[model samples]
Target chain A: MLRLQSVRKHYDTFDLDCSLEVKPGMITGFIGANGAGKSTTFKAILNLIRIDGGEITVFGKPHTQITAKDREMIGVVLSDSGFSGYLTVNDVAAVMRQMYPLFDRADFMERCRQFGIPEKKKIKEFSTGMRAKLKLIAAMSHGARLLVLDEPTSGLDVAAREELLALLQDYLEEQEERSVLISSHISGDLEKFCDDIYMISDGKTILHEETGVLLDEYGILKVDETQYHALDQTYFKWRRKESFGYSVLTDQRSFYLENYPDVVTEKSGIDDILLMAIKGERL
Target chain B: MRGMLVKDFRLLLMQKQFFVVIVAVSVFMIASGQNTSFIVTYCTAMGMFFSVSSIAYDEFENGYAFLFTLPVSRRGYVAEKYLFGILCTGITWLLSVVCCGIYEQIVRPASDPAEQVLITAISGLVLFVPLAVMIPFRLKFGADRGRIVMMIVTALLFGLIFLVAKAADSFPVLKQAVRAVNGLSGPALSGVAFVFAVLAMGISAFVSIHIVEKKQF
Candidate 1:
């Protein structure tokens, strides 16, 4: 379990003030565009960057109070963050074994074999996908209770991504108390795996909700100008004009179905919600 | 702490400077032609340089970050570094002594007692004190910038020393004062001075660990 409360950080042109929580046994997807404070938040939580305000806690302990033993339960994978390129996969494994007491050498070697990563090959010579896979192997082999991954699938091919997703699904199924917080640009992967999604924009959380609840509560309604005027403004989360009519996002789908039988209503996808939230447009 | 030390040793094994220091000491021992004092002094200076450069290498390689993330505490890291420096200097000093002993058996067949003891003491103090003072500063700032600052400071100190030596040579009263300071003769006094220097180094090392622990990556 993780909680970030009123965490604020400032740069020359951007400011971050956001709060969120990741409950155990849930896979939470952090979705945002580039430079949307995802990496900053992760860095702050890891103490790689100093926070100007607010507190972060993991497993009920404050960030600073979390001892090295506490960190044993946390596994992290950062995009493009690693050791020198000259190190081979085996070298990395050895180094990690030294750093983590829970590190299983057999599991790590097995993962590398499963992922088709050669132990003797230098990381600099590996493709981006291979590098990502190596990092994932390193993070997962330690039997961590909480996995924090930043764009772990950014460079993978479709097959590799599917394999990774399947692995994650199996991993979650096996461990009931384990939780994961992942940020990715690929919405479809998140849609398939994440139970909850948090949409972040401009350093603030725009929406945070259960995926099923979101789909059940929100609906896209196609209405003509007249019908749009008749609809209550309070019900619209986002609305936009089309050539023939308007598409309105509303929380009460059942009410729209009963009240306006002729209007077309459909379930909105995560991408649609994300686009509308970020663009600040209403239909 | 053991993990960090093992990793540091592995990294040090890969470094060319380690080999360079070894070779330089060997050559110096051979070239000294059974001169025990020369061998000890040369090896001590080489050990000092090697210790400083190894610390620089650790920083350049981002080794500290990885080390800190492990279960080892900040104080432990500092303690390990101090131990490493002392261990390396001791080993190099021992090797030099062995080589000198071997050469003495082959050629001179006699040991100069006063010269041997003086060289060992003076060389150890000169090398260890500078290294102790500089390592914490280097770790705090960085390798390149820290080295530059250290060079400037050393230049200034040497300039002041040169001026004082010149003044003492020209003035009888100043000469007497210098003689009085240097002429104090007792192994007990030297032991006390060595203990004080080691204490200062220990305190500096502790302070360095505190600073590093509070640093935000």
Candidate 2:
């Protein structure tokens, strides 16, 4: 549903060149450290910030050409921005009612009630978890075809995060054509939720892999200097120097498991993959 | 646009206490026999400020980013603010006029209520001049810095006005021009002010749209 091809944005201190794709009915997770250009990528896709070069298309049209009507199908949850803090939930609902013809106000309020979001209190007065919930609710309430979520689970508790992920799963299950592009610091959330994952670092996309491949095939292979020298290096993606010898990241975990039985093969999660991708040296 | 209007109006309602204070102060001043024209202008100016302040609220805590993420275009956002500004300022102008008219009848029966209403109505148009200028300033510099910039600009404006008055006092050509302006009939003067106000608002809105369109977030 969305594609960004080498989208470029330049700032005084940072420059971004990113490429990503979210296919229909798929959930794509974006993982990066702070200031790694995840939010910039999201903003570029939304056309909130002007890109220096490259092209972004949403729903088969250039992002710049997407009209307000087209945006009605795009649900967005920004990390540090939201409805004006002065507005209450009721006020936001009233505004949403006008903005989206398909906005499910009843569903929105029911979700709010389910989450214990008070309808009368100013959003600024809401707790961080409550505010996060409200943003999620708003994004999910409208019958959007795609959701561009930046840190949607940032302030929520563990249970709340699980609840939100479950809700997202429900949202996707309800519509076979729907898609989501989400970024979060919490790798576990992405691991449990995303169909595919993109790893970004220093404003560039460093890795993109299906979540199952990343988890099932990718691994950290710990080896002393003797074993490292003896083992075949064919599948090693990255290697980092360690006190004992080296920590090698391999994409062919089973190959190592079957061939090099003595080597320690630890299954790599999203966090482990991100660490290796960022800190390890290519072999 | 309608969604944006609802958001801005809802934001303005957060300061319901300010509305009460404005009304209470206006009523108190009118009851104490203060100049009705000043009261009307005071209420009108105060009410118009809410529209300008809505810009600040939209910008608070990085709210503008999310606002644009909604189904709002840059031009539509600017249009909504202008429309809301007119709606807010017009309502207050009407309310102040009614209050002043009532006060004129009950407390100052000797005063020409019709003339007072006319002067107050014209002042409403003049009031739009500042609203016109403030929107672009606020949009360009943001809220806190915009307020500081506005104070400096207001000082410069007053200085310019004083200089013009001094020149009018000394130069016959300038003095005659000033006298001509002062001599125009009430309706004629209001009509001119209306045109000037509309011109200023159009330029201000244009500049504001440019500011927003060029903004990164």
Candidate 3:
């Protein structure tokens, strides 16, 4: 549903050459440290920023060519921005009703009620969690085919995060063709919800893998200095030096598990993979 | 565009108290035997300012990032602001004129109202010129910087006018041209002003659309 092919954007101190794809009927999670160009990538895909090079296509058309009619098919939630805080929930509803032809106002109000978001209060007066919920609800309310969520789960407590993630799952189930490209600091949230993962660092896409492959095949093998030198380095994607030993990141976890039984091998999560991809040295 | 209109008008409604105060002040001035023309000019200017302030509100707290994400195109957004400005400023102009007309009919039955109304109506058209000019600057520089730029622009405009007036004083041909304009019939003069306001707003809207389309969130 969405594709970015070597999309490049440059700044005084930072540069981005990112590429990722979100297939229909899939949720793609973007993982990166702060200032790793995740937000910049999202902005580029949304055409909110000018890209220096490369192509971005959404629903088979160039992003720049996406008209208001085409935009109606995409919903977006930005981490640090939303509707004017001076507006109340009812005001947002009124505006949404006018903006989106297929906006489900009843479902939106119901979702707001379910989340305990007061309809009368100005959005500025809302708590952080409340605001996040409102942004998500508004994005989903319009029968959008794709959702571009940048840190949608930020500022939410555990329960709120779970609820929002569950809501996202439900949103995907509602339409087979629908897709999501989400970025979040909470790796666990992405691990649980995403179908695939894309890791970026220093403005470049370093790794892209299925979530299942990341969870099941990727592993971190910790070994003492002697054991590290003795083991085969061919399978190591990257490695880092720890105080106790060398921590080697390998995509072929089973090979390390069978051949080097003495080395401590632990399943890699999204965070672990990100740490290795960003801070580790390539073999 | 309709959605934008709804949002802008709703934002304007948030300052209902300001609207009330403006109306109350105008009513007080008119009732206290202040110049009736004051209502038209004051209310119309306030209306224009209110409309422009909505652009600032949209940009507040990075609001444009989310706003542009919606189904709003930059061109549509610019067009909507111009339409909203006209609607808002025109409404206030009408209200103030009606208020003045009512006061004259009820309290000063012997006074000739047509000439005053004509002058006030012309003032309303002239006010559109600034509204037209301000929107593009606000779109380009944002609200705070836009205000500073507007002040400078206003100063330069006055300076240019002063130079022209001085030139007209020294040149008989220029003075005759000015006199010829002034000598036109009232309807003809008003028509000229109307056409000028429309042309200014059209050019301003085109410029604003270009500015916003080139903008990055």
For residues B16-85, what per-residue lDDT tens digits would candidate 2 score against the true structure?
A: 9999998889878877878888998999999899899999999999999999989989899999999999
Q: Give the TM-score of candidate 1.
A: 0.83
Comparison by lDDT, 1 against 2, better one: 2
Best by lDDT: 2
lDDT (Cα) of model 3 = 0.92
Q: Estimate each model's TM-score.
A: 0.83, 0.97, 0.98
Local accuracy of candidate 3 as per-residue lDDT tens digits, A1-283: 9999999998999999999999998999999999999989988888889999999999999999989998888999999899999999999999999999999889999999999999999999999999999999899999899999999988999999999889989988999999999999999999999999999999999999999999999999999999988998888899898998888999999999999888899998889989988889977
Superposed by TM-score, candidate 3 places the C-alpha of residue B138 at a distance from the truth, in angstroms, of 1.0
Clashing residue pairs in all predictions, respectively, total 4, 0, 0
* Regions of model 2 farther than 4 Å from truth: B109-113
Clash pairs, candidate 3, are: none
Compare candidates 1 and 2 on TM-score and give the better one. Answer: 2
Per-residue lDDT of candidate 3, residues B68-140 (tens digit):
8889898999999999999999999998898888887888899878776778888899999999999999999
Which tens-of-lDDT digit does each residue in A222-279 have in candidate 2? Answer: 9999999999999999999999899999999999999999999999888988898788
Q: Score candidate 3 by DockQ.
A: 0.86
Let me know the TM-score candidate 3 reaches against the reference structure.
Answer: 0.98
**What is the i-RMS of every prediction?**
3.4, 0.6, 0.7
TM per candidate, chain B:
0.79, 0.96, 0.95
Error of 1 at A21 (Å): 1.4
For candidate 1, list the clashing residue pairs, or say none: A238-A283, A239-A282, A239-A283, A240-A283
Instruction: Sort candidate 2 into its docking category.
Output: high
